[model samples]
Target: MSIDAPYATLDPDRVLDAVTACGLWPDGRLLALNSYENRVWQVGLEETSPVIAKFYRPHRWSDAAILEEHAFAQELAEAEIPVVAPLPFGGRTLLHHDGFRYALTPRRGGRAPSLESTEQLEWLGRLIARIHSIGARQPFEHRGRLDRATLIAKPMQAVLSSTLLPSSLHAAYRAAAERVDRAVADRFEAVGPIRQLRLHGDCHPGNVLWTDAGPHFVDLDDARMGPAVQDLWMLANDEKAMSALLDGYQQMRDFDFGELALMPALRAMRQLHYAGWIAERWHDPAFPAAFPFAGEARWWEQHIADLHELSEELT
Candidate 1:
């Protein structure tokens, strides 16, 4: 669990030992292992219900994020928001094991849809509106806001600083980074105050779980206070999808059209962030093809082209 310890090779026996120590299940078959930055597993025993075990990466995630998520989950539960509830383990919101921190939560019964239908998209919009409304009334602080600069710097820095990626990707990464930076800078300067608010940060289809209650959002790991439009842009990267989601969102919350116009560029920048991260972590095959730069450069080229098209429409 030391930072120097090889994180890629986790000991299954040690993880099972940790499970037993937690008093949940000493002997249960590890059902599935998810390839995330953090260690995740589906643990189940015949006598008891199944649950998810998440081991946090030390130094990678801030303690504030862990605490904030627990607090936010509790607040949402109190408000009857259909979100995953985080359970306290090891007398702390986060549990320490093998030099790393971990948290456990009961796995809800449902799966995320690959694509959001019109009705589902509308429901998602309303749900987000409600979350924003509730979050607005609460006193909270985020590590930082998502501006053009932060969106550009974090990924660029990650790409440049990462030792995992090869030298061949450096030039392509820098060029893409510069393109995103320029686009964001020009777009932000033209538009003022693109409606900042508490956002889920990552609202892609993967994070949404469809349950009997409706769409329930999980994996609030990236939740933070940022531009309200950020979530919208993240969800609606394509015109058809954006229109559907926006139609759904507008039904619940009042928003300005001006901010909607900025979504394409915002989304393009967001895509670049993921792309750069994937390039750094490309050695790992779990990176999704949906994000920019993960596949051929043509995908990113099209995204940049879309940004240009959106800019003309906005003007």
Candidate 2:
């Protein structure tokens, strides 16, 4: 953490003071939460329950984009969807202390959602559908949509720019990546236009918290305009689970069956994006320590091979 340039200035005293800046008294309990793109902490209060403070990554989002995320969360919460929205401090949700932009929200606890359970998948599907319903009501003026360029091409560029890929493997990497890129583009064109809507952009299991009562959404950091299927595909691991989820989803809202075929391309884009994200953020001390595999030459070999395999499937 000390080696990370982004968090170098953010110490324990500063974190607590950021809370105090919001007119909250800190009990001096600060625990680092599991987040890499941005820094998050569980800050204990002197009186009431603890609050989750999320310090936004520097330069990643503008003020309007961040506020748009807050507004979307509030919209979902207002619609009776169990989403963890930011709490206003002095009627402002976004705050700044020193240089970091941050927000405060009530801490909600739950375990990872059970994707294997049919009932759980259905419940999650319904909640996601409801979220999409609210998401579809309007458009995001600031946050950008999830698309092929951002997810695929941009990431592959990051990998090429970085020294992570050995010199010998550069040609192979580029060939595999370009092949995947063209195939991904073809799939998107074939799918024609998709119903783009505001979505929980990164809707994987890790982002969802499940309790006995039901699941609640946390972390709107990745919230953006995207296909509704972007929120649905990551929740299921197999055909059966996806079927259950779609069954529950169709009960509340009509879904485009065409988007189902777009999964492979989306998955391929995500694969490229993941590698690219690690490459782009490798300068951050946290990324290298966490993704040691990216440091290895063989990983690049495997990644290129995987890209080739994905290209085969896509073509």
TM-score of 2: 0.97
If scored against the real structure, what TM-score would every candidate get? 0.80, 0.97
Global lDDT of each candidate: 0.66, 0.91
Predicted candidate 1 versus true structure: per-residue lDDT over 67-97, tens digit per residue: 8777887777778777886776655667766
- Report the CA-based lDDT of candidate 2 relative to the real structure: 0.91
Once model 1 is optimally superposed onto the true structure by TM-score, how far is the C-alpha of residue 68 displaced, in angstroms? Answer: 0.9
Off by over 4 Å in 2: 1-4
**lDDT, residue 89, model 1:** 66
Poorest 10 consecutive residues by lDDT, candidate 1: 285-294
Model 2 lDDT tens row, 27-86: 999999989999999999997999999999888899999999999999999999999999
Residue runs of model 1 more than 4 Å from their true location after superposition: 2-9, 114-116, 138-142, 161-176, 237-244, 279-315
Best by lDDT: 2
In model 2, state the lDDT of residue 270. Answer: 92
